[model samples]
Target: MKLYVIVSLWALVTITHQIKTQDNCVCEFISSEKPFPYDKLKMMQDSASNCNNLMSPQKAFGLESLLLGLNRRLPQLEDDVEMLEKEDDGELYGVLSLYVIENELTEIQAMIDKLNSSTSEHKRLGDDTAQKLEDVKEKMEELETFDAMQVMKKQQANQRLKRDLDQCRNGGLHPRPQPTKHTEGTCPHGRFLNVTGPRVFTTGEYPGSYKYGAWGRDPKPEEGKESWHWLVMLTSSNIYAHYVRFYSTLSSIIVGVSTPGNVLIHPSNPTTNTIQGPNVVLYGGALYYNCYNKDAVCRFNLTTKSITTLQLPKGTRYNSKANFCHLDECYVFTDLDLITDESGVWVVYTTNQDFGNLVLSKVEEEENQLLSLGQTWRTSFPKSSVTNTFMVCGVLYATRYVDKNLEEIFYSFDTTTGKENLNVGIFIDKMSPNILSLNYSPLDQMLYAYCDSKLVSYEVLFEKRSNFYL
Candidate 1:
């Protein structure tokens, strides 16, 4: 029984050792399992080490070590087999990873060099294109400047040709018409036609004059009733030559010449000879005029045959004396000023009321009583001797006799600010002989000055302003 008991104890000990070995195998796996970043092959090696320490004897555990090593290495061998699944996930490792990164960086450097080369080439191409564009711009500017110069030259040549043509026309040809022909006669349409003076050509010197020249009045267009007629005022003549029937598209028409009536008491009595006048605006309705022995503004209504005097503010040298001393124009102001489309008026009588102070007044609304005078503005120079006034762009322009040499200076002043834009100088550099009368035409956009016997016209081109500036 003792022998049997010893054998039983030995068998129990062996069973317990086997149980311990199994538990250690399981515990080794649990403790040394590979982390997520660890390679399977490397994890297998680590697991092998743990197994040897836990279950192997100092030399080698008999079958147990072999079995345990097999258990650990089996998974590593399987992992090696599945290395095809590694897929080079491109994560950091040791020297091998560093070497791979350096190679990639070298390739990137090569690509960067290519990109830089392409960029530099593109920039050079862009610079060439820009240079070509600048050349085109300069060429265009040159062409424009050349075109402008040619236009100016052409205009000057044309002016010279016209002057020569006028000279040839006036070089003397036909003898004087019979004095009987000078008798007052009616033109077609029952319009009265009267000749004020003979047509004479002016050239060199003449007697009893600062300048030798002929004086006459004729229609500007010499056509229809739509044309304007002039009541020309000549210098030598004491009266304003009233050309009865003259027609023209130009505003410088000579309708008549009459004296501005002066208030002179009769030598014998106080209230004797009341002032009378031939002064009448053909368009303005006529009213019998005699303001304290001086002629007042009177219009004779042709359609109604009724005359009426314009009621002007009273209180001047001769109160109620509506004498347009130096009449400048009697034409439509539409084309001249470019303001006809709006509420505008037809201006007449460019006169210097207070010395050289220019007075530009007009009589509008010929047929209606609703018509009245528009705004009256002041000018820069004194009106003592301004022969003509023209309005452009809401500004008043006047031609004043600078001297007896007929050297005239044209100036403009803003009606609103009452200040002068001194930039514009005297336009006349070539015009000599004093101008007897002046007028403007919107249709032609020309300034016509009647000097001596010659009728001259100046082309006036206005500058275009930007809409933004306006």
Candidate 2:
């Protein structure tokens, strides 16, 4: 009996040592040589208690690795949930987020399964910690059913297909699509093939005095104004301008002609209707520009000398929220860009509803002689990604700075086909650092760019369409 007691103590010590090694080894005591008396069972129980005390370190080793992986992922999941919860119907976060959460949860579930299997015969975690884990799992399940993305998707669809409020008010459900393109064959210049030659270059009268402005001939000129060239210099803090100076002829513009009776946008500089931003167009005997500190476009008539306003869509990013940018700097207050091509006049902008993507809208003159917004189309191209944009033959071409001297037109959004072309690699030779405003003239087939303090124009090369061919 004394020998049995000594052997039991030594066996307990050996079992404790083996468990400390943390190897997959089972520890148990069974005498096969003979049937032990019932009295020996109590002694074995005491031995088991001593072994458990010595092997306490083994328990930590079992769960520490699992907790580390779980620790790394839970915090990340928390961060993702916080951001996702911040989304609303106005923002666009779609099913992409669900996929990310599903991937993370799937990995965590596998770890949970392994943990359950390993701890089946023993309590690996205290009751409190296990309860906390169960709570986390429940939260994850709730997160899986989050509907913010669904709401955003539906809201986005509604906004994308919806057009101007003016059209809706004029004609109820199924309003007529606003006119965007002109007669295809009317442009004798044909489909644009390439951009070549800085056909015209001039430092306007202001020259270095102003670093940002717009210069071009009016596509729809008033009678006797067909030979006119216009220049608008943002004389106040490079953002607000009150007047537009006109040069009689192209040669006069090159010779630095002085102004005679400049068209005033507003009486006082930076007033209510004054032009804001560097992008403005002189079209149809009027100057179109973004209104001062507002998301609406203002048309200041050179003839009637009256002002008309056309408010842009809701959430339009004015006040420089969506400015054209490159590696160096962004052109400030370029949020509402106005450009002219063969297709009358168009406004380019971005809205929060569209997730900061480019939106193009047409400007129409109602029979009442007031300006009303026409059709609006949202494009997939992000507005903040490009440095400048222009329209040629009714196709919108977007450019980015290729180098200090080269600006490349790499994207085109064709509204006619409802398609976007990203490989339109047309390059512009820039004489200055950046092109603040770009405009296309159908009359001369020229592309004009307002670079820093210089006015540069390029000849648009094109192949005559087969229908328009001789």
Candidate 3:
């Protein structure tokens, strides 16, 4: 029996020594190079722990060497991890993590299998051994949960990236449809020079059902008038308002010039009463207009004959005060606001006295208020004064007569800045002089001045030389 006991002791020692040597060999191999094989490193670590009795100083040195190798390759490992994240390789990461766990668990399983295969007469393991087994099992479960979570996160990130790319290609924010040429044509006189004036019939011996047409005739140009065209057909000379004119850029249209005759209005519920110029603006699928002397902003629904009116301020010239103020001559069409917001129509008008006092007021939802003085500015010159009432670059400009020589002066003012542009003038010798209107066209980036009852357009030609007004 003693001999048997001695023999068993010797076998155990030999087995322990052999395992130690094997672990050392593995560690030595791991420590040899960078990008240490993680799977192999993990196996060695597990082997060293699984059979601690086999460990020796040389094996310990080998284990330390493996740790050093891992440290050296740490930066590379980090790069791999980052790349993995960018690529959304959750499955790969999970697989690697699982491999490490499986290697450890497999070691435990091998030991368990060895214990099971041993003779029944052999000694049993202690409580500590059983506890270690249970711990390993718990670690495997945790790893499984971690793997699932990583997979879900990667999938979500991938979906978000796809959505962002799609938005970039589709113009996520301000998607605008491309504009196409409308061969069918717009208003016959070109895009109707949008006007805000009244419609009156021809008086005298002209017989017609609809005696007159709305003025501010922005008709498309005719084919032959490209060089110097003329649209002269005035059904009536009685222009109650100044909103009856528009100029065309395209020469392929024929806008009728004034015809020799009288003007009249179709009698209606309001007796088709005559008013001032039509205050017209095209916006939101409708033409907004108001009678020359009426105290209301009227909307003529082209889609439907439905006429809607919004009340103007009590002080507007559209009332009896307007006729009297006009020296009993009646107010004519003035100008319409180019910009339309939810607030209401912004109309600028001239007083009948011609002293050059311009009024700025808003036709709100249903009320009008003469804008305060601070909100308005006027331009004055030698013999004439004009209100800088028109808008360009969100700023308003007004012109005035500097001399009887027809030298004209203009000033630009910012409604928001309250700053004014320096006075500037254009000179053309021997030309009839009249400051009909000044306009800016955003489409062509040009500024126009109407003088001598004719139009002369100028290229603004330079950047705002100075925001001296800034």
Candidate number achieving the greatest lDDT relative to the actual structure: 2
Per-candidate TM equals 0.34, 0.59, 0.34
Which ranges of candidate 1 are over 4 A from the true structure? 1-237, 240-243, 248-308, 317-356, 359-362, 366-371, 379-381, 385-387, 402-406, 416-418, 429-432, 464-470
lDDT of each: 0.35, 0.74, 0.35
Evaluation by lDDT, superior candidate among 1 and 2? 2
Residue 250 displacement in candidate 3 (angstroms): 1.6
Compose the digit string of candidate 2's lDDT tens values, residues 136-214: 5565444435543477568767786665565567686644223233223224566666776566665646556788898
Sorted on TM-score, highest at the top, how do the candidates line up?
Answer: 2, 1, 3
User: RMSD, each candidate, Å?
Assistant: 48.7, 29.2, 38.4
Better of 1 and 2 by TM-score: 2
Model 3: residues with Cα > 4 Å off, grouped in runs: 1-237, 241-249, 254-275, 278-290, 318-345, 350-357, 361-384, 403-409, 420-432, 446-470
Q: How many angstroms is residue 409 displaced in model 2 relative to the true structure, after the best TM-score fit?
A: 0.7
The alpha-carbon deviation from the true structure for residue 375 of candidate 1, after best TM-score superposition, in angstroms, is 2.1
* Model 1, span 318-389: residue lDDT tens: 321222222443221111111110123324232325432444444454556533556665454544334444
What is the TM-score of candidate 3? 0.34
